[model samples]
Structures are given as C-alpha cells and as structure tokens.
Target: MEDPYEILGVKRDASTEEIRSAYRKLAKLHHPDLNPGKKEAEDRFKAVSAAYDLLSDPEKRGRFDRGEIDASGQERPPERQFYRDFGEGPGGQKYRAGAHFDQEDLSSIFEQAFRQRGGPGAGGHRSFNMRGADAHYGLSVSFLDAASGAKRRLTLPDGQMLDVNIPAGLQSGQVLRLAGKGMPGYGDGEAGDALIEITVEPHAFFERDGNNVRLILPVTLKEAVLGAKVEVPTVKGPVHLTIPPNSTSGTKLRLKGRGIRGADQYVELKVALPTEEEIELETFLKNWEPKHPFDPRKHMRGR
Candidate 1:
C-alpha cells in the first residue's frame, strides 16, 4: 500500500482539515456511482477511501508517524534490544551478554511479580490467556441515511465485509462496537470488539443543528405575497409547507417533528423575483403608493 499522505496528495505536516478536504475531492471524483463500469475509477476510489481511513484517525496517525505501525495500519516488529542497551541496576549490576534464560525462568520471574499482587498466576501455573486487541475502522454515510437511520456494509482493508447499523440521529464521532469481531485472541481467551467510527457527509441543501434540520427555501415573489402551500424537502421526504401572506426573506417557519427523531425542521423563506423583467410588474411598482411608509433602516439611524 502507498503512504496515506502520498495517496491523498497531502504533505506529511498537513492539517486535519486539509487532509479531509483532499480526500473528499478525490472520493467524489472517483466514486463508483460517478464513474459506473470503470474499473480504474473504482480502484482509485477504494484506495482513496483506505488512505483516508488510516490518516483520519489520530491514534493511528501518531503510530504511523512513530514507525510503530505501517501505512496499512498493521503493527511493525519492535526494535530488538541487547544487553548493551541496558544500564547498570541499583546495585551497580550490569546485564551480562553471555547469560542465557529459558521459558521456565521467564515464567518464574512473572510468577513472583504476580504473587506480590495476588494475581491469577500467583499460586498456580501462569494461564497466559489474554483477550485480543480491538480492531478500528472508519465508515462514511450520507446525511439522509444518518438522520433517518440505515444499514450499511463496510469493507475493511483486509477485504472483509461487516454490516453496520446506523441509529437515527447518530452524531459524528460516535463509535459502534461489534463484539468478538476483532483480532483473534491468545490461548482460550475471547476475541475483542470491532470499533467503527462514522463520518456523515454534509448535504448540499440541509444543515443539522442537534437533532433539528435547517434549510433555506426559495419562494416565488407571487407566492410570498399571496401565500401558498409549497412542497418543501425534509430528511424523510417532501412535505407541504404553508407560506404566510406578505412573507419576506429570512422569515422562519417550523415543521414540527419533521427532523431527525422527533426534532423540528426550520425553513427560512427567501423571496425570489422573476429572472426576466416583467414590463407590467415594473410599471405597477413605479406608480405604487404605500399606505404605511416607514423607514426600512430606522434601526440604523440611531447608531
């Protein structure tokens, strides 16, 4: 596998936001849906996703930087230490290079250590049964899917497919644990869990606030002036929203229980005029006389 930084075209010292931005651009360009039936694009997309999976994690990134792990996220062998690497003990005793040790000697050394703490191997033989380490993974989901609750199948770097259930109103940085889905355990111990971190892609039209949803809906000038029921989009689907008469830009309307879970959706109305000029409308406005003429910037006058 290529270095994650090089794969994402980011420098080693790049900021988190910079790395994320690069990955997003590459992911979009090589996404399978955007390039259907193109094997090259699909491969590139997978590589980009994998690279992001490693670099986006702080612990993994630090380990990789310290040479404790590889680009593929696998652990590297620890550097070997010899007698010369050790210093003198409290009694000025130095480690002897010619000294030999066997499995029984190591077990007895551990036995004494456990005996002091009254651990499992204090009185009996050492079991040495240990649980495996937990596995970490990353998954990306659409905004609607995250808000509405959906199931996704994640492909791990090892080519394993794992089913993931995203709960409704799931926030970013939340982890999902799959029991016994991690690395194999030693001896008779059980396996560890699989920790999956989710990243929700931003929607082009909707913004999330807590569990609530926000949107800026464009209404025609006539509709704003005369009032009408228009189809508005929600995370679930489109619903009819009533625009009050004389509605103007920045007028906020609430759709109860239309957001993620039981939260509400806020729609701000923006009155949009005709793209082409209307001679009749222009003439009417020119001769229009307002019954109540008030300063539009009255608040600005005092300041």
Candidate 2:
C-alpha cells in the first residue's frame, strides 16, 4: 500500500476532521453503486478506505509517524528489543539480549528459567503456547453514512488499519466484530478478534424517525396564506410542493422514497411573518380586516 497520508491526500499533521472529510469524498466518488464493474475504481476505493483507516486513528497515526509501523499498519521488526515486552522474566527484570540471540537460544534460556522455578504442568513443563486476549474499540459514523451505508477504516490497538463495512440503516451503539484485529497470539496460537462499538452522530438539518426523515421548512406568510408551489428540502434534494390555500403552520407533507430505501421524508411547514423592513406589509395588515371571520385559536385556552 502507498503511504497512508498520500493515499488520503492529507498532510502528516492533518486533523481527524480533515481525514474523515477526505475519506467521505473519495468513498462517495468511487462507490461501487456509482461505478459498476470497474476494477480500477473499486481498487482505489479500497485503497483510500484503507488509508483513511490508518490516518484517522491517533494511536496508529502516531505509530506510523514514529516509524514503529508502516502504511499497512504492520509492526516493523524492532531495531532492538528484549523478551520481557512479550513475556515474564526472573525478578521482573529486563534484558538487552538484542539481535545477538536467535529464537532458539531465547526459547532455551526461557525454558531453563522456567525449569529452575519448577514449571506448572506435570513433570515440571510449562505451557508455552497461549492465544492472545480479544480487544474492544469504538467507531463513529455520520447520520447519513449510517442511513445510506458506508465503508470505514478502524485502527486496531496494535497499529493495524482495518476496513469495516457499515450496513444501511445501522443504528447507534451497535457492535461489529473483526477477526484477528486484536492482540497477537502466542506461539502456535490463533490471534484474537476485535469488537467495535458504533456511534452515530446527529444531523444538523435532518431528524430520523424510523424509516422517515423529518424536516422543518419555513415559508413566507404570503406563500402560506395565498398558497404557492414552493421548493422543499429532502434528504435526496429539493422538490416543489404545492401549499394549499389557507394552509397554516404545523402542516405535514410527505415525499415518498426520498429518505432511506422504501422510506419517506416528512416536511413540516412553518409560516414566517415579514420583518420590520417590510413596512408596507404591516400597514396593509393594520388597515385590512379579515373578510372571512375565522378563529384559528378557538380551541386554545383564553380564546
């Protein structure tokens, strides 16, 4: 894989928001739905997703920046190390055996140390192989992304960038499992998995109600009273909706299939009065009396 920052088209010091913004733009452009049967687009999409997976994470990004890991999130062979980082030792001590000792030599040394302490199993032989512990993590997605489906990159604790598939209509606080994304297994043992919890962020202009998207649309008082064909916003786009004559605020209008698949968008009308700048309107209203005697608030208290 290419350098993660290069793949995401971001600087090494880019913020999390910048990384996410780049990922969303690239992923949307090359989404399989937009380009069918195109291998190159699919490949680039995957690469971009993988890159975002690494650079979006602070820990993995730091590791990559410090040269402890590569773009693929694999740990580089240490320049120098001792066995204590991986396991226990006598007197909880540290060693500087370095590259001078081979794997077999280290195993022999550990075996001798264990034998000196009378190892656990029968005949004083300790169990050498054990599976690593599973890890847990959290991932956040946008409201639209959660509703429309998306692919995201998660950074594992060990500096791995994992590609996560988010299903459409995914709710908040959901759990996703990634096999072998957790801690590395011990000798001859299988690596553990990672469990990721999903968090969905709130939208500024859209509210989700089951399969529907609710939006409040404001219109001029003239448009509401005289009735007009006005453009209303939906998740997909804006559409012209006819307002019936004498329609008041709190009126509901539905646009079918404009939300999630098989879902609708519900628009609520809010009639806005003219501001002080429109003095003519205030004068006309002061001199003109209602031709039709109707009490809209007759049902309210103190009417």
Tell me each candidate's RMSD, in Å, in order: 6.5, 10.7
**lDDT of predicted model 1:** 0.81
Residue-level lDDT for 97 in candidate 1: 60
Give the alpha carbon lDDT tens digit for every residue of 1-303 in model 1: 688899999999999989877876887787666676788887888778767767877877899999878987665644333233344554988766665668996666556544543457456455555567566566789999999999998765445678999999987878899999876776687997888878898999999999999999999999999999999999989999999998989999999999999999999999888999799999999999989897868889869
| Number of the top-ranking candidate, with lDDT as the measure | 1
Give lDDT for model 2. Answer: 0.74
lDDT string, candidate 2, 1-303, tens digits: 589888878887888878877876777676555677787877777677667667766777898899888887766654443344544446855554453567987776666555544455335547545455455455779988888889998643233578999988887767787887766776666886776768789988899998788998888888888999988776666898888887789999888888876699888899887665888887897899887878877889575
